[model samples]
Target: MKPDPSLAQRNLFLLHHFHNDVAKALHEHMREQRRRGEIPPYRVEPTPSGLPTLVKINESQRIVLHTRPSPLAPMQAIAQELSRQPPGATLIFSCGLGYLPCALAPLLNRMKVIVLETDYDILLEALRMNDWGAIMPSGNLLLLAGKNAMEEANILISKHGSLLKNGIRFFPGRILLDEETPTFTSLQTIARESQEIFNYRITSNLQVKKGSYAIVAGHAHKELLSVLCEEAGHVNMDARPVLRRPAVTQFVQTPEMWWESLGRPLPAKLLTFTNKAFLPSEWDKMKAFGIRRFLWCYDDPFRATVDDTFFHHLDRIYCFDPFLTKRLQKQSPIPVHFLPEATAFSEGAVGPPPWDIPSTLPVTFVGSTGLQRQDDRLPRLVSSRDPSYLTIRQFVLDALAKDERIHYDELMALPVEFPNFHKSARVVLLEDLATFVVRLHFLAALVNTPAKIFGDQAWLEPALVGDISRIYAGRNLDYLRQTPWVYQNSKININIFNVQCVNAPTVRIFDVMACGGFLLTEYRPFTEELFRIGVELDVFHSHEELREKVIYYLEQEEQRERIARAGQERVMREHRFRHRLPLIFAAE
Candidate 1:
């Protein structure tokens, strides 16, 4: 009455199918056999550098893999089987389609596999269809959800109901069974009973439900990882390693060197919020010991600064201009401040008016000419198609091309010209723009000349105006002192623009007068409030008036020198950074 030995072996395999012992034994045996040279090794070892160590095989037939039925290595063996499969042949899976993907990964792309989803476990059925897309390349795999099982799988439809496609027919009634059994048990019992009695084939649709529940289709990778992890039953199966941290925190060298160069005048400390847009090598060292404010510049309006928890630790949020200031004020978790920009001042004054004709005739301007409308040289747009003239754009383009980081180069290139003035006469230059000259205090030194330029255009275009000059790509301040215009003219000038009425006197005018240059500038209503027109500085209304004043000033040498001297004295006395620096440093 004893059972046949072959039948007993088959029963044992069936009973131990979900236990995964067969898979573990097969994996260990294969490794040992390969080491002993009993079988050729088919797998590659991983590298220390995290790169894969691939196995080199010239022909597909050379591949041999250990495949045994186990819950732990289900996908591994299935994938191995897929590699050896021939195209267009269908491999019928007795288990749910879910198990087919991991086991047949290698064949998924090249050969056909038809999955028969028996009505076994609802969770297994749900899990199997999750990563069905990975099997898509193996276009040979078809999922058949048998007719009667379709209604039973409706529970899946309810949870992920929206993913259902059109034309699918539902089964009639639910299984009526003992309530004491586990859900999976009841499902399997029903499945085996139906297969034996009615010869029913159980399976459910593998197509993802569209529209409302379609999110599942896109999450195939995540679901596949989850399934692999669950099937492995590995409490500590970590495929990816944690990122390594350096043993030492590196410190930069520049700030310390700069501090040493600056001597004791270095404030108790310094802070700089910077962008890669500027040279960080010099700034990086300075940031190590002193306070470092890191403000990453970005043009994307939708960037979320709040998610950057690191920004809140900085003291002052330094930006290149007020526009950046305004943008940061809304989202920045720190106080924002503007840093004054630097310019090289040409050495010496234009000298006094001559006895006969003046030496420096018509003033010259330097800078680039761009699209007529989009340049600050031509401020007004003649047509609707014109874009605003902004020096920042030029600065960005030049910086990108040259990989240089010094700021205000575009402003340094302003076009300064004596439009209608006599060649021998003195003329004032104006350079000041709201967003362009973020800090205007540096303009204090250029005020000593008889004929100085004023207004936003002067600072915005100092090179052309003769206020500040530099040799191409030179970083030395001495380049400004070397320019010819520094010694040829009667005096320099200063003035603010109308757009800057809301703010105080622009910095260029202040710097000009402070530098002992002559001052001749615009006639703003606030000009008189700050200084006497004839005594401290000369102001003109129209272009014609500016021409006439230049001529008159050249004739009246003493009067021009007295006014220039007085303006320089007043600016140095009251308008220096020492007097107004406190208001700027206060916490807003």
Candidate 2:
């Protein structure tokens, strides 16, 4: 088969040589071999500060050699050479290694192909021995096997010493091992065995040294030239030193984290407020631009735990409930914004109503109710549950029994003291929010729809079940039956806590609303601001009003639907995490 015209025209396939003593020695040897007629004659052409290349051929039949040539450059050269070659030109590969396909396959149809494999077993054995304890146990073995298999196949087509006569060279940078370095010797022995087993002879003088040029060899002139194009540069014989230095730190503290005691970036002027994740509406608009920071004032801080890192990193602080704001205002160093706690539309509005509920239903109340000793709650014994109540009552009872003071009925008949105290003076609240939750539950049951109270087992065990459950169910004349408002049947059921906030319209409302039920919620500032009293949500004062509202809303569907729909829109729009995330990340 004829070589490509351009390749044929080029004379002398010079296997690139590096600027090294070994390359000089090899060049002189090749020249002597040519003179002795042991090999084809070719002229040496030195590349400028580059690896030695096979250069100058007269008959276009001289071979050039390279070992482990750079894969990228060779592949490109092979592809280009194939493009110029005539159809049916025979292109023989002396080594059947994996790398050749990347360079040879694209030109396969343009030429005839032949492979020559050398001793295969030695290559496999060599690879295995060297790889037994290497860090990459699996990968090294696979690579070794692949190389051995390919080289073995090469031996079948080519003569035993054909490669040596054609040309054989090592990549200069490849470190050969010596006895002085046991580690190096180990590796060299492995390579030597692999070469012998694969039927490729290794030079007895092959040393554990660093300065060797990457050499590629081929049997044909065209193939030799193709490999020559891959030689990049001569091996560095002088040896270079590596310098190490510490890296400089690049840290930028965002403005939000200013008071963290670490220097922080200047705070941006924009401000944002949210209790939960950023709102989607706010996030979407700001995502395209650089957002500065956000402030999240979490309410129900006791019940609702949050990642403080989030608050610390946020630009400012935000609290929905006034009471929560007051408690945390001084405690937090960040500026706090008090957002009114609003009504959240429960699942009912988004999905189908859980039950057949009218706009106006029965009276309802929902809040926490729990027991504690009065001694647990006093100014002196703040941990006590109003010790004054018990202390005063016990004292009067003792005095009445001794006939030394007014009797129980006489004390009860006395006018109530400071009934308007709550209106006149500020009172520090200390009770757990769960107690309020139970109260709201019964209040809802009494007012709007038959109360569907939702809380954890703790709430049910003490407030709804056991003695109370038997009294309501078995007695047939329960607390509701004795009261003016009565729950028709098993309409009231307690639910577990879905979210944290007590004032916020929780999933209980959604459960009821989805069932087409109404929601009678606590009097939160947000409820009044976000939802109309007669339309979206019904606000309650005391347990009595809660009961009345529940009954009124139950009987009034027109009013209930109006408020439910409005509340649903508000919750889905304003309260959902998706809707709120943007506000969370918003620039402050």
Query: For each candidate, what TM-score against the reference?
Result: 0.30, 0.32
| Candidate 1 global lDDT | 0.35
Q: After superposition, how far is residue 331 of candidate 2 from its true place, in Å?
A: 3.9
What TM-score would candidate 1 get against the native? Answer: 0.30
Question: In candidate 1, what are the lDDT values of residues 77-150, reduced to their tens digit?
Answer: 54564455444333232332244444565554555443433333321222322343345333343433332223
Residue 134 C-alpha lDDT in model 2: 18
Error of 2 at 359 (Å): 16
The sequence of per-residue lDDT tens digits that candidate 2 reaches over residues 1-588 is 122344311211111111112122233333334445664333322234332333224376543333324423554555565567454322122222223332445554433233222223222212222221211111111111222323322321122222122222222111122332453234334434434533432223212222211111211122222322221121122211111100000011112111111111212222332322232333332333333444444435543334454355444665655555665665666666555432222243232323444332233333233222111122222223244334434444454235332232333333333221232211112222223333433333342234443222223333333232221211111121121122111122222221234344443444343333445654544556555766655665444565565455556667656665665565555544333333332424
Model 1: worst 10 consecutive residues (lDDT sum): 241-250
Most TM-score-accurate candidate: 2
Please, what is the whole-model Cα lDDT of each candidate in the order they appear?
0.35, 0.33
How many residue pairs collide in each prediction?
68, 126
Model 1 misplaced regions, further than 4 Å: 1-268, 271-314, 317-333, 337-479, 483-488, 492-507, 523-532, 576-588
